[model samples]
Target chain A: MFPSRFDLVVAQTVAEAVEAKVDAGEGGRFLAGGQSLIPMMKMRVAFPETLIDINRIAGLDAIERSNGHLQVGALVRHADVVASDATFGAVAAAAPWVADPLVRNRGTMCGSVAHCDPEGDWNSVLLATGAEVIAQGPSGERSISIADFVDGAFTSTLGEDELVVGLRIPVPSGRSGGAYLKLERKIGDYATVAVASHLELDDSGAIAAAGLALTSVNPINTKVADAEALLVGQQPSEELFAEAAELAAAAAEPRDDVRGTAAWKRQVVRTYTKRGLAAAAQQAEGS
Target chain B: MEVNITINGSEHASDVEPRTLLVDHIRRTVGLTGTHVGCDTTSCGACTVLMDGTPVKACTVLAAQADGSEVTTVEGLKGADGLHPIQSAFTDDHGLQCGFCTPGMMLVGASLIAENPDPSDDEVRWAISGNLCRCTGYINIVKAIQTAAARVAESSNGS
Candidate 1:
């Protein structure tokens, strides 16, 4: 199916893009990798009267480490995140399971976050890492925490005039690492359930700082705060991990969809969170 | 919208809608139809093409977004007098059955070799995960990629 009629504006800067969007009114969209948007548009699930092409904007595709954080520009594709230098290690671990090579080559990390699909793999990891989203608008730029950026599935806290410019993630300060574990029905399919785990070990090999999140289990805001709280000051052991994983599963409020039943997803969340936590703990131990 | 795209090492100018997918432009405007569209969504690699030397789903990329960028389609993989080594490997290894997924497999296979000349069987499988082939059980597909990698390495070494 073809998309509805729309005009195009090539934006060389953020201001121009925002202005174009404002002029185009509520049906305006910022076209990035188009991996997610175009497909929806084709199916008539989404329609924009105008598209502000942000690909021409310079300085929006750089990945850098600065001021104790890793800064990923809005145009940084998943392939770039995988191949480029790591600001945080876990985003790369999740890259392999994000669609496939072709989609990875074109899909932008910021785009995925902006789409805010509850089933997206990046949200769990980004939320787990407490990644900050940077957006620019007529009123100037502002940063939204990943926790606050996503309001629900396909919804965000973004102002209609704002465009995501980059994402900032804190660099682990100690013996720390992260991992993204996903359960997909097929080799290339949306995850049934995914977990992102970040752990930092103290001098005694106990969990110092930990972050945990879940995706595809619905509610779009599936943070295991208690699960994370459970790991801190706790010894690294399979029994403890299982307890936290069970808590994470219990907290999930997923709906039954084509992916899986709510019960099945909860079980997956329980299992994968443990696996993700274990993987992160191992990496932290190695470091 | 007007687009001046550089595809297959040649620059061509055309008028396209802002909604025109790169795959359609490559097929309708430039008339290079080897790039198949198995899934209009980004799920299938049947529409894969190298945009600035990186494999991307052509069906998801807008022609306007691809303007001023270099693209290498399956048609561009042939040598002056014969099929590319990867294509030949497909024939020898029986990598294809229905042949619908061949172009994408060959193109992505070339990219895999370029990125990792001696990719392991697992690596080859992972690289083509975006593409789906219902024929040959993918055993020969993996073998074909391995064979192509060897031939490509041999040719480069000889050169």
Candidate 2:
């Protein structure tokens, strides 16, 4: 059972949800899927005096392709996104592997993004894909790129009364492919180290652009721009991938934990980075 | 607050505490005890149910959040004629020994089969990863899901 007692307000609209939070002032917490918040409450980590349930708000759970990008509503569950045709194959693949099936069914992309756990799979994937977060506050709606939205672990740029309304992922062009790989000690646990890689190929089957982001290695998801730069203008041969993986390993700043030591995590990051990039390169070639 | 929700295709209105979870509402107020609460945290799938046709853990969802939604518990999965195919498969394959996790396993498994009737073994394993069963070692549970998938596919084809 949860420790704190709070008023439950079922908001019928986005406006109502916001108002409920504003009215509750500092004591209110917005509840979407509650995959993160409820667990915290049960552990006495969070003790909000009021809970604004946003599940009833219409038009907040949708996934569609729009204007050459995938626009996913905030309430769209991880399971729905994984099963939906709108998300690109690589992005969809990340959803099923997040936590477990029940969590995937209830956890939303926005919720995971907002939670901003260092080991969160969605956060790492969003960073690699250069996705944008859409936030709505009492004043108005605003959009922030994923890089700027996540400040650190368990933190985001969202204001007290702000809500994440949606996410926008730009579709890569011309034989682009992406993949996410994580090293977990066991199933349904946070990743010890994870990497999400996206590669775009030129007409000559050479890498045109690449994005690599590592999670659970630092306080926040870190984009290894230097490592990604190594892949450009080159094919993903074992030698090239080795260099990129080395760079990613060098760039990471993993911490010691029960799952693994910093050195072990660095090694896992290097290994998974190489594997993910290799697989992504194959997917790019096929495309 | 007073919330009106449709459970198992029946309308129910109950006055609950503000902090009451949907799992408690279903089990206590609606008198459907099939949905068990295994972990207070959201890690366990013992409280799994379908809210508006999507599988979600009831323990995490507040009852007020489900105010106007259509909820389907394990009890709701049965037709007037007999048990749902997933439930039948669980029995046929010996998916449960203690049966504490059976309700949630059935709910999540049914949802998985509903979405992908021909899930691979890997997919079947991935689908029920959240629902933990200590007694069965998950071997028969996986077989039960596959069995249910076959049954559902056959029934749909026959229909």
Q: Work out the TM-score per prediction.
A: 0.97, 0.92
Q: List the residue pairs that clash in candidate 1.
A: none
DockQ of 1: 0.78
Alpha-carbon shift of residue A75 in model 1 (angstroms): 0.7
| Candidate 1 C-alpha lDDT tens digits along B67-118 | 8999999999998989999999999999999888888899899988987999
lDDT, residue B81, candidate 1:
80
Docking quality level of the chain pair in candidate 1: medium
Output the number of the lDDT-best candidate.
Answer: 1
Model 2, TM vs. native: 0.92
The pairs that clash in candidate 2 are: none
Q: Give RMSD to native, each candidate.
A: 1.5, 2.3
